[model samples]
Target: MTKKIYWAAVIYTILGLLGGLYYRELTKAKNFTGETQLAILHTHLLALGTLVFLIVLVLEKVFALSETKSFKPFFWSYHAGMVITVGGMAVHGTLTVLGKESGGAIAGIAGLGHIILTVAFVLLFAGLYARISDKQPVKAA
Candidate 1:
């Protein structure tokens, strides 16, 4: 997870910067709808790609659940969700570049992917939190 987050941070940073530039171009072209939608996608990608992944990595390290049953599932799900979400966002971005008003399939897929990825991350976080905090010390130091 730590390694995953490190890579994600690098990729996300690049993606975010490029997305920002695209957004500026959209604004300059007076394409408000495209700008807004792509902005949402960009923000989502940036947040999940960097912040959320890092948080998960920290949680994994702090909990020391390398061999735990939930660890593998959590890791795989998060990454899989990321792939789908990112791919969908890319599709949407391409379509946006082509000047599509409705956004076609990309919009629907991106929306769905975002929802799924959000849920996957939440579940992963919850599982890690539960495993770590479920047992409390009977006595404090």
Candidate 2:
């Protein structure tokens, strides 16, 4: 599990770097000057993907989070949410760069992604809390 978490962090970092490069080159190629959703892809991937996973790795080392059943569900759901969210960003950003108007579907999809991410957070925290509770040593009254 630790290895998996470490590798996940590494992959996310690479993806974040690639996202930045893609955004820069894409906008430059099109000479886009104004703000677009693409501008945020890099930060989102780095902060949410790379940074979050790195932090999770540390927490796993200390708490052995994967030992909890909730960890598996949280892991899969988090990845699904990220894929949906980042995919929405890429689509919306591309359409923006191309001067195409996206109606409301993109926003809806992104919202769903955020909802899933929120659920995943709850799962993680629940599992962490449970683990901590089990580890607590009662003091003599």
Candidate 3:
């Protein structure tokens, strides 16, 4: 599980770098007015997705978090939320750049993604709390 999380972080980092490059080039061309939104998507994907997974790796090691019951759900929900949220942003940004308006459906999907992210975080925190509370006190060396 820790390995999977680390790999996910690596993948998201690569994706974020690519997205940054894409945004730079697109903005340079002045063909995509919605490049800013794509940039936001890129940041969120790297920060929330990549950074969060890295944190999870640390938690797994420090707290043995992956052994908790909540780990699996937290992992799946968070990744799914990231994908949906970033995908919605990409679609919406593309449409905007094309001078097209996005309907309520796109916004709804993004909203749902955020909601899932929130739930996942709650689960993660709950698991962390459980592990922390269960920890034994450190003894002097």
Top candidate on lDDT is 2
Worst lDDT window (10 residues) for model 2? Answer: 132-141
TM-score of each: 0.67, 0.93, 0.88
Each prediction's Cα RMSD? 4.6, 3.9, 3.3
Candidate 2, clashing residue pairs? none
Q: Backbone clash tally for model 3?
A: 0
Query: CA lDDT of 138 in candidate 1?
Result: 18
The pairs that clash in candidate 3 are none
Q: How well is each residue in 1-141 modelled by candidate 2, as lDDT tens digits?
A: 899888888888888898889889988999988778888988888898889999999888788888887899998899989888988998899889888997799989988999999999999998888778985322233
> TM-score for model 2?
0.93
- Candidates ranked, most accurate by lDDT first: 2, 3, 1
- Clash counts for the predictions, in order: 0, 0, 0
Which digits, one per residue and each the tens of the lDDT, describe model 1 over residues 1-141?
567656867777677677767766766676455444556656766787777666666765666543345556666666677777767765666566566654457667766776776767666666666666754211222
Of models 2 and 3, which has the larger TM-score?
Answer: 2
Runs off by more than 4 Å, candidate 3:
33-36, 135-141
lDDT tens digits, residues 20-93, model 3?
77667766676665434677877987899789888889988788787777889998999898888888887777
Top candidate, metric TM-score: 2
